[model samples]
Target: MNFTGQWVAFKTIVYREIHRFMRIWVQTLVPPAITIALYFLIFGQLIGSRIGQMGGFDYMQFVVPGLIMMAVIQNSYANVVSSFFGTKFQRNIEELLVAPVLEITILLGYIVGGMARGIAVGSIVTLLALFFTDLTVNNWWITISMVLLTAIVFSLTGFINAIFAESFDDISIIPTFVLTPMIYLGGVFYSIDLLPSFWAKISLANPILYMVNGFRYGILGVSDINIWQAYGMLVVFVIIGFSVSLYLLAKAEKLRT
Candidate 1:
């Protein structure tokens, strides 16, 4: 496709995905906001009060970044996985495969759409959190960069998962089993500093921990892991996911005969 044609295709896919989620705002957006509010009330207010401060900030402030990132990660991933799999189940993806547009463009377009929704929801959650606490961003660039990169990584991941999913239940497996555990143990509720020496060392192996703390450092200026290392790992994941998603799309891996 020519530049103009590519632009049109990209815009159409993104607009369609955006409208899809926005039209069902209750399902796509409101749930995460409500969930976070509950977290603030229960974990931050009730349990957190007894738990005491972590990494120089109040419990609510420490968790705000992780919560926001969690929303971004989950929604970005869920949006694309479901959106792409729906197209596959309906056989609509064949239309894109048969079109003159390049596969990389198609893949990137959908990923961008997912990232947009993720960032949008995360931003809303952040704004909502502000109403309950006085939060400050220690480094705007790192914060924004990490969030964007994390969204893109998960968005691409969702696309890849969709390619391999064979049923509706398949789509839910990763989020339920893998993603949920990662987010919960990802240093969201407590600091690694408080963990036993052995457990703290083991937690380092969880990649999500890096992202959670990296974002926390960006907001609260503190982290259990090196902030730069977190940024590096996220960039690497983006590159790897983008490359693999492009390859799958270009080859029409599961979509074409």
Candidate 2:
């Protein structure tokens, strides 16, 4: 396809994706805000009161970055998985596959959609967090980079999940069984430093730990892991996830049929 043709196709896909979630703002947008608010009330206000400080910062302050990152990660992954799987279930993905649009264009269109939802939801969570604590950005560059990279990584992951999912239940299974557990143990509410040495080392294996700590470092100027290491991990994951997603997209017959 010519450049103009590709651009048009990309724009159409992205627009459709944005419109899909916006059409149901209540479901896509409102729920995360409410859930995160509850976390602030229960975990931040109630439990955090007794806990006092973590990592030399107010408990509420410390948890804010993690919670925001959590929102971003989950929503980004969910948006793409659900959106792509919906196309497959409806048997319309075949149209895109057979079209002149490049496979990479399709992948990017869906990714951009996921990133949009993730960043939008994360921003809302950040605004809500302000009510619970006076948050500050310690490093704007690191802060923005981590959040964007994390969103891209998870968005690509969601694309992979969608390709492999055969049913609606399959989509929810990973988020429930795998994603949720990792996020909770990813230092959302607490630091790994608080854990025993063995468990702390084990926690290092959870990819979400790097994301959370990297984002926390951006906000609070402190992290359980080196910020550069976290950035490298995120980049690596993005590359792997994107490559996997493209490979799956190339297998259009298997995915669509």
Candidate 3:
């Protein structure tokens, strides 16, 4: 397609995705905010009183970034996976597949839409945290980059999930089993430094660990892993996810059938 036509397609997909979530604001946005508040209540106020500081910050302060990033990751993944799968289920995706828009354009459009929701929810969670704890951002660049990269990587992962999904159950499986375990065990509550040596080594293997630590570093100026390693892993996932999603889009894999 020509430049003008491509731009139009991009805008259309983005508009649709944005409107999809905006139309259901309570469903798409409010739950995460409420969930974060509960975390602060249960973990931060109730349990945190006993647990004390983590990474040299008050327990509530230490957990905020991880919670925000968690919201971003989940929402970003859910937005794309459910939206794309819904399109496929409803037979609406055929309209785009038959169009002249480049596969990457469609991917980017959906990705941006997913990231938009992710960032928006993350921002809301951050604001909510302010009510429960005093906070400071130690590294603005790390904070912004990590949030954006995390959103993009998960957005692509969700797209891949959508492509492989044969039913709504398939789409929900990864988030329920895989994604939940990763986020919970991803060092959201305590630093890996607090773990025993063997468990610490094991925790290092989780990709979400790097993301949480990196974001924790951004917010609290403390991290259990090297910031470079976190940035490197997130970048690698973004590259790999983008490539795979593009290929799936080009092939029109489960989407076309």
Candidate 4:
């Protein structure tokens, strides 16, 4: 397809994705905001009071950025996986395959859709957080860039997961088993510096740690991980995720044909 044709296709897919979640805002958007609010209340207030400050800031402050990142990661991944998997389940993906749209255009459409949800949910979570603690916003660039890039990475991964997913059950497995564990341990609740020398080293292996800390640095000016290294890692993941998602998507189409 020509550039205009591809652009039209991309917009259509993105509009469908945005509409899909927005139509069910109660289910897709509201829950995460409520869940993060609970985290602020229970962890940031009730427990944080007794625990004292973390990473040189109020406990609530320390946790706010991580909570936002959490929302972004979860929503971004969920949006794409569910949307794309639904297309697969309904077998309308064949329509896309036969359509004049390029694969990259389709991929970008879904990624942007996922990004919209992630950023939207993250914004909601951030707004809820304001009721609990003030965000000084140490660096606007890092804060904005981190959230956008992080959302993109997860969206691509979600696209990949959808490509390989065989059943509805398969889509939930990674979020439940892999993503949940990573987010909790990803420096959301506490700094890895608090970990013992040995465990702290192991924590570095968890890629989510870098993202959480990078974003944390953006708001609170503190992070357990180096900011530059975190950006580097995120960039690398973006490249790898995009390449892999494209390959898997092509493979899936070939198999479907």
lDDT of candidates 1 onward, in order: 0.89, 0.94, 0.92, 0.92
Evaluated at residue 85, the lDDT of candidate 1 is 98
lDDT of 2 at 252: 64
What does candidate 2's lDDT look like per residue over 58-135, in tens digits?
A: 899999999999999999999999999999999888789789999999999999999999999999999999988998
Per-candidate TM equals 0.97, 0.98, 0.98, 0.98
lDDT of 1 by residue, 148-180 (tens): 888998999999999999999999999999999
Clashing residue pairs in all predictions, respectively, total 0, 0, 0, 0
Question: Lowest lDDT 10-mer window, candidate 3?
Answer: 248-257
Q: What 10-residue stretch in candidate 4 is worst by lDDT?
A: 248-257
Runs of candidate 2 with Cα error greater than 4 angstroms are none
> How many backbone collisions does model 2 have?
0
Which parts of model 1 have CA positions greater than 4 angstroms off?
Answer: none
Give the higher-lDDT candidate: 1 or 2: 2
What TM-score does prediction 4 earn? 0.98
Please give, for residues 46-140, the per-residue lDDT of candidate 3 as tens digits: 99888888888888888888899899999999999999999999998889888888998899999999999999899899888989888888999
Pick by lDDT: 1 or 3, better one: 3
Cα distance off (Å), candidate 3, residue 11: 1.8
What is the Cα-based TM-score of model 2? 0.98
